[model samples]
Target: MPEPIIEIKDLTKDYEGKRAVDHLNLNINKGEIFGLLGPNGAGKTTVILMLLGLSEPTGGSIKISGYDSTTEPLKVKKITGYLPDQVGFYENRTGLENLLYTARLNGISGKRAYESAEKLLDIVGLREAKYKKTGIYSKGMKQRLGLADVLIKEPEIIILDEPTIGIDPKGINEFLDLIRKLSKDKGITVLLSSHLLHQVQKICDRVGLFVDGRLLAEGNIDEMAEKLFNNKEIAIKAQVSNITQDLIDDLKKIEGIRKVSYSGDWLIIKSIENVTPAIAKSIIAKGGSLYQLSYEKYGLDEIYQYYFEGGVRHD
Candidate 1:
């Protein structure tokens, strides 16, 4: 396995006698989208700042690509890009102009900046609206422009804080797709921090769940589900015209089949593993016709609610 590009150990932060981030420890692998997920004031923003070298940690260590983020801020900043929850752009300036201006600020100007700005504008899908004044741009368009603004620096790591906040569902979907592309195509490590559970659940490769300044859990969805629910219970719902007590009895006899019940035409199943295939096969073997089978798998939202509701799970 590749080494982690960002590593945090015992990271803590305090503000005015309150602990904002507590003994935070986690890792972000290269070219992967790592989500720092939590509600507001969960220290997500503070962690982003520390990763970007914008703020100091009261204690602990942060290393980005082997450079100490606290002491070697210049080296860290050079490879990291940040987009705040609300990105600020000049309303009077055109999208193209905004990126070009930012490129110049990063010390790359003239033709090089123009080319880079134009390419990024195209990359973020804002090229058609590039010449228009950003004051007339919609919130989604502005968000895309903000993305292009950050990419002008050509940073290897991108930190986005609630990038989809206030975006329409369609826009949010598009933005998440763009994020996936950034990691796959550019090999850039992305740290997305947000309170929105479903959106984060959809795109993140791995996630660290934070609550009140501490990380409560960290892993992929399956791992999280295992940690939270002891191998998540899958509910398979099926519709069948033919019903039989014999069919129910046979399904219950199957190994690892936790439970089985039905209502009207809906056959509901509870299992540790996928029993849909077995159920369908049994339906065919019997005189029943399988009309429909749909299953629901547990994701971050379910596990999040479990922890958020104060339930504990064993490793």
Candidate 2:
């Protein structure tokens, strides 16, 4: 496997007399989106702060691209871009002006700065609003612009915190699409910290479920499901035409098939493994028309709820 672009080992943090992060460990590969998922006050922001060198960790270490966040903070910041939940810009400055200013700060000057800023504006679908003052930009518009701001620095990694809190559904989709496009096109690693499970599930390649400053689980949805559920059973739903008792009996006879039943217009099959193909073959052989077939894939929301609500021990 390729070396992880970002690494955190036994990372812990404390505020006042309470611990905010506890023995957290994670690794993020290059060109992949890693979601840090949890609710409010889950220590997500604190971890981000430590990673960015904005706050010191009470214990443990963080390394970004091989630069120690604590000792080589400047080097870490040089290759990392951060977007806070609430992005701020010069309200009186036009969108283009804001981007140009950021580019200048990053040492890209003269015509190069303008070209880079304009390119990012177009890439983010904000070219028309480039000349509009940011004071009039909506929340979604600001979030997009914030993305453009982060890109101005040409950082290898971008950290976003609560990026879609108040945007409408359509806006959220568009913003997320832009993020995915950037990661795929530029090979940038993204650390998206958010409380929204569904939105994170839509873009993240892998997720770390965080609760009360601890990482309860980590992996893609399917991998996590196996770890948490122990692969005990799988549920499959199928819609077939001309269903009969004989067809149901045949399905149950298939190896690994445990139980078969009818729910509404769908046949629900509980099995020890995914037997979708076998189920389909049986349906076709029995002269039944298959309309829809889907297997139970655990979603992030279900996994989060199951683990957090005492379905499993954190240990």
Candidate lDDT scores, in order, read 0.87, 0.90
User: Per-residue lDDT for 126 in model 2?
Assistant: 95
In terms of TM-score, which candidate is strongest? 2
Candidate 1 regions exceeding 4 Å error are 231-297, 310-315
- After superposition, candidate 2 runs with Cα above 4 Å error: 231-297, 310-312
- Per-residue lDDT tens digits of candidate 1, residues 22-130? 8988988999998888888788999989987889999999999999998999899888888999887898988888888888878899999999998888888987999
Tens-digit per-residue lDDT, 149-230, candidate 2 = 9998899999999999889999999999989999999999999999889999999999999988899899998888888777
User: Clashing residue pairs in candidate 2, if any?
Assistant: none
TM-scores for every candidate against the unseen true structure: 0.79, 0.80
Model 1 scores what on Cα lDDT?
0.87
List CA RMSD, all candidates. 5.1, 5.5
